[model samples]
Target: MTDFVDNVAFIGLGAMGYAMAKNIRKKMAPTGTLYVFDVFGRVCEKFRDEFKSFGPIVIVESPKEAAAMSQTIISIVPGAKEVRDVYLNNNSGVIVAPKNEDRLIMECSTIDSQSSREVGQALGTAGTGKYIDTPVSTRMQGGVPGADSGTLSFLIGHSKPSDTDPISHRLEKVATMMGNPKKFFYCGKLGAGLAAKISNNYLSCSILLAVAEAMAIGIRSGVDEKLLHEVIQNSTGQNFMADVVQPVPGVVPDAPSSNNYRLGFKTQMMIKDLGLGVDAGYATGIKPTMAEAAYRVYENAAVDPKCIDRDGSSVYLHITTTQEDHQE
Candidate 1:
């Protein structure tokens, strides 16, 4: 009631959004309620049941309804198209909703930096709600487990619409509940968060592709897969995808590959994120060699019936399998 921006609504209940929303509810529930809304009502329904221990998880019908009811809105949908639909679409989106100068509209999706800037422009033109792009980093392999533990680092970016806004002051407090408050970094200026996130993800996806291909080559060259992994992990070539989510099975006991690469960041999503990075490069007149190459790798694997739904680590299998097919 007395805290800054007591009412909060989360428009997307996907992995990160759900975790962040749960944390916000746990922290802000006593003072106010956390409103949950998604294009898919089932996600909100399931989230409502899961957050019983926390204060009320109020569900709403649409994004516009969510904005109307809450002082702060956090949306973490997939890409730029979805972002535009949620914030800029006039018929059903939040941009046309009744003016509320006190509200904060935050987009947490990893989209092109230009889209973030345009969305901020739309918000300013609408004359209601300050907008910010708060894209999170791709180092977030924590999945829902980390959300359950409440330890995700967030990056905040201030757009032109948020130039003079004090929404971040409220965020400084609310962000601590979402993850390590100390890890929160303000990138400054609109789309900076998206740019930063895309940059981080570009490294992640590109390294994943490069490492997977390298692993496939090592395996084909008669190098023991797990042994190579251990050597690399102990050597200077180690990384999260190599050491933690090692694409090779039995290399890392907890890696997705150990369990058939069933559940983690999907191959399709990785391709999508990589494409965003590629777009960023195009916008800046720079060639995204690694990112584009990685995108092509993932794109090839994504269409494979086997790799379509598998974890991004499955790119290892994709590479090895393609090489096998080529040899025959």
Candidate 2:
């Protein structure tokens, strides 16, 4: 395994990717070279200019180009299909190798475990590029430019142990570049990372919806919404639903909920993840009632223009308002 401190490629210049790449540039020593690629040319250019002070910035034309130029490639695309298309898909609709065997490919997208396995298998067959799933667990606000200092938990699934593969060690470095390193578990296989992420998100969605429904009941019973939030905060509920993960607004000032659901994590994104969870459950013959419920809640919220602008936290408002109106 080669040191990832020097050459790095980051794909997908969306909110999360942009901030993560910037942090890598700021923290990496030995004057790291950053190769960035985004479908939008404007985004690539903007990042190039913004991080020019760090070191050499290569704005690549495509994922392959970026892969060709860097030793370690990190992808934070939208979903599994996009992840496959960028890393495995070739111009001729076939999968091709990006570089040599020592090269590391870290996929940071939140996707299904099965699809993650497929990508990992393809990379294995190529006998060159290594694949790892290192999905992030932080709201967009947490990844904002200067807010890189904020903490984030990582679920890393590497193909092999760090002692065996130098690539695994380099990935740990990349993980810390984004935020304070939480956990970089060497989950047994390639798809394990995706599995962990899917399960985590499913439970998160379920908790959010459950809290939302409970809070809505409080609102309908004449409890002030703000007061309800405060009461919940002071009670045992605060341990999990309120403190570790808040579902309602004004509870955590820095959370997406407090900001009226703007630019944290979109409801649509939550719906997508829930959908993935549902599919995973069905395939594994496991009950997914909570995931299904969360999906429906997000599906309805996505249709509302106001909710569309709000963060995933806005699900609380939907639950509260709907339940309150029912009683009226």
Candidate 3:
């Protein structure tokens, strides 16, 4: 174990985090240590075995251990509750770690803006670290593949929005370790990252449902599925979901639709994120008509056994089979 200057820590070894951490470890200096933590011990072990050759990968027991030892901490957990647990759970959370002003904490989950603010406030008061919300996104429906390929975009919410701020430069330097440099957006103050993300997802999920419904109508009207999709792709109706992540099977050969709608963002999680957008809309006194409608469809689809654990686009299958549609 050689002494290194840029020791960094990453938490959450789930689908997105695993790939993000893998890229971080691969891009890290040979001597720098990459500390990782996850609630599942097996995931940590697997990550170490798989990526240790890229750099020194240290598997720690808790967020405290990871934060205590690293100059920068990046986390992308499941949801708000898990986010609070990893950062606020007194005994083991990162909040209890030694106070280190130089330590920069970046959370990359697409949780509610409120939770991001809560953790940011707690970190500020505790003086453990500086907290920034950095929720991940990508062009089109590039989910896991975006993380794996290191082309993902990050929405950053830092205290200093100025491009010349030393802290902002530092944020980008570390963020580009797992994201595209040109694709980074410093979306304003803390909580703004999630605000941007929730808004993006609100539109993305709505488009997903719209695409699903349009495809259903076309197919039911005797238009060939792939042909209808191709027409839409070349016509005015095309969008990312239509061209890149077509929900219709055989339209996109490698999409989740072709793979039984598995290994993508789950329908239940889509509902949760949509609900976040809907709640934000109400809180801001703006009616999110399309988001609310999409939310209802996803909520009902999530309860169906066939679509519950499938990809969010599985709503296509649900709509075609269930005979329920949202309309004028």
Candidate 4:
């Protein structure tokens, strides 16, 4: 691979984006220039000030400016539409056509495979820059400590194997700066990363829903929620959900689930991802009953003010509370 580039531009400074950008600033030593842009002026200014001590923090007006100023452009926008608007929409005057063939564009949004392919095609045809779909699997909290430790797992979709090597190496450095770089898989093709992210998240959401249902049943049957969680933890269900955060209340006392579900992964975001998963499944004519059901539950919860304030783990509270309130 070629020598790692120093200057980088980051678009979208949302919770996760801000953390990733901050980690990049910390790890890329000699302190390379970092240009950032977001719809919120305050976020841009905040990050600019926070990272100013580390290196040069340029606050730009738009995505195009950020793309134009750096050798590599990274996007961590919310959804497929935002990703398209920031990178591919020519009408917005924010499309950053690459200055040379060496430039790289990495998108870390969790969207669908189709959207990823379309965006990748457009960016690739722009001729100067190569695009890579590198959606992350870690949670928002993971962003803070995860960035510095380089423990975030990345599933990458690249135009070609050769085009990916340098970007992967650079991202590993960036990931480790944030936390510990665990797994970086080159999944192949332009949309593979998006597909992998959605598939993984669908399972996560499903498991959380299952855990919520199980806990609700146990609580209704006079079984303690903590005991049920312990059994599940010792069982095969002890994946990320059991180890990191449980969806049921009283399972993990320190988890967001026990704290009324405030500030983790928002229910609105989970609903959006479930929608994407449903759409993907429908397109393939595969029945995703569990995923579709979970999507509806999150969708219903998103409208509730309490659930809206909490993370996806709050689904357990919704199930348990509703069941208790409705019980005879």
Q: Give the Cα lDDT of each candidate.
A: 0.79, 0.74, 0.86, 0.74
Better of 1 and 3 by TM-score: 3
Model 1, 1-328: lDDT tens digits are 2334467889888887887887788777575778888888898889889885767778987778887778788888878899999888777788877788668777778788898899898887887687888766544524556555776666678522243656666666666676676667788878887788788888888888878877877887899988898788889888877877788777788888899986668888888888888888998899998887788788888898778888889988878878788889
Stretches > 4 Å off in candidate 1: 1-5, 159-165, 234-236
lDDT of 3: 0.86
Off by over 4 Å in 2: 1-3, 92-98, 139-147, 159-161, 224-239, 244-247, 323-328
- lDDT for model 4, please: 0.74
List TM-score per model, in order.
Answer: 0.90, 0.88, 0.91, 0.89
- Model 4 sits at a Cα RMSD from the real structure of 2.9
Candidate 1 shows a clash count of 0
Encode model 2's per-residue lDDT on 32-63: one tens digit a residue.
68888888989989998987887888888777
- Assess the local accuracy of residue 48 in candidate 3 as a C-alpha lDDT between 0 and 100: 94
lDDT minimum window of 10 residues, candidate 4: 140-149
Backbone clashes for every candidate come to 0, 3, 0, 18
Clashing pairs in 3: none
lDDT for 53 in candidate 4 is 87
Candidate 4 lDDT by residue in tens digits, 90-208: 75423555455566778888888898888777766776476788887657335334544556667878533454476556555554454444466668778888888888888888887
Q: Give the TM-score comparing model 3 with the true structure, all chains together.
A: 0.91
